[model samples]
Target chain A: MVSRAGVDEIRAILDGVRDPEMPALSITDLGIVREIRQEDDTVVVALTPTYSGCPATRVIQDDVVRALHENGIESVRVEVRLAPAWSTDWLTPRGRERLREFGIAPPSGIVDGPVVVSVACPRCGSFATRERSHFGSTPCKALYRCDVCLEPFEYVKPH
Target chain B: MRDSARIEYVLRFGDGALVLAQRLCAWVAHAPVMEEDVAVANVSLDLFGQARMWLSYAGELEGAGRDEDRLAFHRDAREFHNVLLVERPNGDFADTTVRGYFYDLWASLALSELAGSHDERIAAIAQKSRKENAYHLRRSQDWIVRLGDGTQESHARVTRAVDELWRYTGELFIGDDVDAVAVGDGFGFAPEALREPWLERVRATFAQATLDVPPDTWMQRGGKQGVHTEDLGYLLAEMQVLPRSMPEAVW
Candidate 1:
């Protein structure tokens, strides 16, 4: 039997596991880590994909395992859960700040219905931005150009 | 037989996604602009992911030990159950956009309802896909409006595409015994139900773009039942080459 403390420890280790694509953000901060549990002395971590066909998913899964092993935790299992789909609203406040520091605008705000958001420029904090493209370097982001600063940036889409 | 029907039903979703995903990848380096290239590729990636999920579930239901890759690469053209619309060739930019517009519009409607399906797995996949589908619809819808409302050349191209592709769309709304079985089991709904909403939205968008809506024509059928056009064979040949050549190869 595993104790509750063990589960929290696993969660803490996982919180340090960063996304391979956006290394500035942790998987937990990105809100893909759905659940952490301890069963029979094995730590199980559940993850949800931000987008269906993200190439980094497999890499992230491997990274999680490696990080735990390096931290002296053995018998780790990662499960992908799709029932409660991942959403940008789950990005932690600190995660949002990290995105800004990384030069990508966080999602505009908590949204409903449609995902049309007037993104503020991450670098200059200007609200005068126009969408350059509906897609960007990654599936989770869209290309936006700040009219004020004349700077092109990526915005995390509100999915 | 019920299990067989379920497998068949799920394969439709899988094969449609897989075939269209392949079709869209043709535009990766060839799209009109860099942003469009990335957008098309990103959309294809989403479809590929959805294809993997649907095919994985279909394999589990079949219980014949065939996984997603085996099912995708091993299947012959005659075995694919994707709609004729998806297998249709990606012609010009306008043709590809129009084709995607139709499918995305239908997917937007179908997936929203499927998200509430009685089957938990179906609901989960539908819910996840629905989110992506929304963005896809918005992109295609915006392009349709832009092209149809833009220069005379652009308007003519998209109009011709709509005319060419309209016949293939009727097959999406036709339901059969497999759909009946899925509906009876409470995990599926008739596609015919979405047709009106699809048309309403299409007409509204076409109006905004100043494009004339074409009159309904005799619709194409048979893709859902594994009877595909000549296009699917060539598509399968190109997609299945590596796997067909080396049965045991793995990445």
Candidate 2:
């Protein structure tokens, strides 16, 4: 029987697996790892994609499996679940900080609300920013320009 | 009857997403700007994802071998149940944005109600989809405001788009026998229940955009019954061409 401590150890291993698109942060940091359980000899990892059609979802699943296998765990199953949806609120504080360090602004405000919140410039840490476009390098990010720094950056969308 | 109603309800959701996604894809490399191109594509992908989920669930409810791809690629025009608003052509940027704005608002409202569905799977899918739909609504709303309140030419174009597409919007909230049954089964809401909220939101957005709401006139129908405008056939011919021509080829 896999102990609770074993599950923690496996989670620790997964913490090292970075998101393919944003390598500065791990999948755990992104909050896509829904649950980690040990059922008999199998380590079952339940995941939720950041977006329904995110092309990176398949890659993230593969990465989780690979990361577990590399840690000497041969019996692993990754299940993708779509419930309660994925909100940017799931992003860890560490993840948000890492995004800023990588010149990207983290999501701001509520996911389901219609409020228009200003995204601060990640580079200059200035509040003078405007959205250049509603899409960026990936589906989950939007392009913005900092009036203060005059530098363009990506803002991780709140959803 | 219950099972068929469930399938029909699911098809309504699936067809709307799939058809709109296909229309959005037609804008690839043809958008007014690079950023707009990417934005449209991402929205298209989001809708495509939702379509796959709904269609996959529809297939399961049918208990047949049909899957998302089969339902999408194999179905003829008469078999589709998407409202006519989605299958309409992507006329100009204004037309696309106006059509998208109308549909996205309706979809978001419907999905919000669906999230509370008694059917666990439907609720799960709705909960997942509503977030994306919210973002799509925001994007479309933003574009409508931009175009509607922009230069004279832009304002004129958007106004024309609005008037042209207004008639089709009525079909969104009109319930049919399938919708009635789905509502009875606790898996869906009455389409008419969403009309007021949809109208309120649209009115507010149009007010902000300085665009006039076209006066109500004779409304189009029959798309929900697998009847469509002439555009759908041409759209499907292009969309299904690759898949049909190379049935044996694996992509």
Candidate 3:
């Protein structure tokens, strides 16, 4: 059985792994890493993708595996689980902050709710922003424009 | 027999998604606007992802040596089980939008019900897929309303597209032996149960768009039973040509 300390070390290693698409945030910050547990001698990392169709999922999984191996962990397994579906609410406070700093509006409101809370512009911090398109640079984002600054930005749509 | 029924049920979902994704991909560079191009492509990618999940799960249930690629590429036209609406040719921008609108509504409702499935795997996939389908429905519905209510020409075009496609929509909710087995097992819902809600929403959307709902006249059927329109053969020929020719090639 692997020690609890070993699991913590593995997690710390994961913390250094950044999302390929959103490099400003770690996978943990994005809430993709569902669990980290030891099965016998192997460290198994369970991950849930942000969206079922998000293309970054496969890349993120590979990064997780590579991150563990580079950290002196030879026996590592990565499992992708779809249960309980991922929610934007899982975005860490730090993750939301990083997204703001990166000029992308973080998701707001409940996953399945119809009420869309107006997203503030990350550029000029203006409340007067409008959606340009439901799709943005990636599958997880929507294109929005700041009326004040005239800057077009991406808003990570709440899943 | 039970496993086969499960596989069939899953394949129905997967095939519908795959064919629709292929149709949507055809619109990538051909959309009327850049924003719409991106939107359609994103929706297509989402359906492709769903197709991968469902087909992969179906392969696992089948327990034969088959996987997603094998089922997707190796199967002939007669073996595919997608609804006829998806495989129809993309007649125009309005036609594509209407097709997507109809399918998205059905898919959204079906996935919502499937989220409550007794099988954990199916429930999980359904839960994940339902979120994406919501976004898809929103996109399609928005375009449909825009075209249906925009102007004389635009409204007329969308109306014609709606009428042309109405017959194909009936096949979506007709249950068969495979559906019966799945419903009995608590892993699936009878497609019949979804029609009322589906039509209600369709009617509301049409009302908002200022478009009349096409009469539910004699509905065309048979895509569910591996019987498809000639269009599916052409679609498969285009989609499967590369894989068929270069069987050993890797992407």
Candidate 4:
């Protein structure tokens, strides 16, 4: 089993990559990094899509390979899994904060958890946004039009 | 509206999804372009996932205790309800595009109406599905126009696919067997009305693509009553074998 420090190191190494749309947020923060396994002479990273069928998968994969190589780690294999599904619930607080700073609202509240407040807009800090469509931008986020800012944004659907 | 009829209806929808999904998977390596392949494959996966949900639900209705695998695999060619369009071989990317565009047009309307069905279960499923179908419809329509208008080769090929597949278009609007149970119990939206809007959408897209809207003449109709084209039988054979052979394997 990989130690906690090893995971921390991996996380640090992964920081080199950011959500291409929301540049401030790292891939790990976006909740795409599902697991990391260390074998005899290799490191294998497993990931779940942000939503079921996000278009950014190829870009993210390339980023993963580039980042791992930059860290002087060879023999790295990235595996993409669909089971158990990925949800916006996986977004970290820092990630959410970063998404807002990037002009895209980070998903708010918990999915499959206790009833929570509705998502707030990162632009004007309003919860008055209305959902326009479920499949938006890339297919992972639902499009919402913020009445306050009169702008459209993507909301990560809770898995 | 016996249990079997319901199961068949569900299977037809599911089978259509699964079959198209298999064809879409073929593009994983040979997509005309890079991004187009991923988008097509992803949409195909969405359809397959929907198929699993519908078939599993059908099994429950059948009370045969069969799951998705049994419904997907154990069934004979005669049992499938999918239209001929999905089973038609993918001759080229244009053929696939035309097929997808045709299906998306129908599915978008079908799911929208189903979202309001009297059956709470189907309605719930439709609600989730309409979202994806809407995306499929939008993306496919966009591509149809792009290909239909793009170049000499694409224009010629896309038009041919549309002409070849146009005969199958009328079958989607028939709403025959579906009328038996789809709206009998409750919130089933009238299937007949959807045809006109679908036609309008088709016309708009075809016009945008500058392609002729072939007359809706001599339409091929049958799948709703379990009658399918020859190609469907072979598709069923390939799709059903693994589940039938294994008997109880879970993956």
Q: If you score just chain A, what TM-score does every candidate get?
A: 0.94, 0.95, 0.94, 0.83
Candidates in order, TM-scores: namely: 0.98, 0.94, 0.98, 0.66
Residue B108 of model 4, lDDT score: 84
CAPRI accuracy category, model 2? medium
Per-candidate Cα lDDT values, in order, are 0.92, 0.91, 0.90, 0.75
After TM-score superposition, the amount by which residue A146's alpha carbon in candidate 3 deviates from its true location, in angstroms, is 0.4
For model 1, the local distance difference test gives 0.92
Q: Pick the candidate with the highest lDDT.
A: 1
Clash totals for all candidate models: 0, 0, 0, 4
lDDT of 4 by residue, A1-159 (tens): 567898788888887788776678888888889898888778888976553334476688888988888888877888866434456777888887877887776656676577444667778889988866544445555567788888887766554
Q: Where in model 4 is the C-alpha error above 4 Å?
A: A1-95, A98-159
For candidate 3, lDDT tens digit of each residue in A8-28? 888889999898899999998
Compared with the real two-chain complex, what DockQ does model 3 have? 0.80
lDDT of 3 at B185: 94
Per-prediction DockQ: 0.87, 0.74, 0.80, 0.06
TM-score of chain B of each: 0.99, 0.98, 0.98, 0.93
lDDT of 2 by residue, B133-196 (tens): 8878989999999998899999999999999999999999899899888788899999999999
Cα RMSDs of all predictions? 1.1, 1.9, 1.2, 11.3
Candidate 2, residues A34-63: lDDT per residue as tens digits? Answer: 988878888999999888888888898999
Expressed as tens digits, the lDDT of each residue in B1-251 for candidate 3 is 88888888888889999999999999999999999899998989988889988999999998898899999999999999899999999999999999999999999999988999998888988888888998899999998899988999989999999999999999888999999998899999999999999999999999999999987699989998899999999999999999899988896
Specify the highest-DockQ model's number. 1
lDDT of 2 at B201: 93
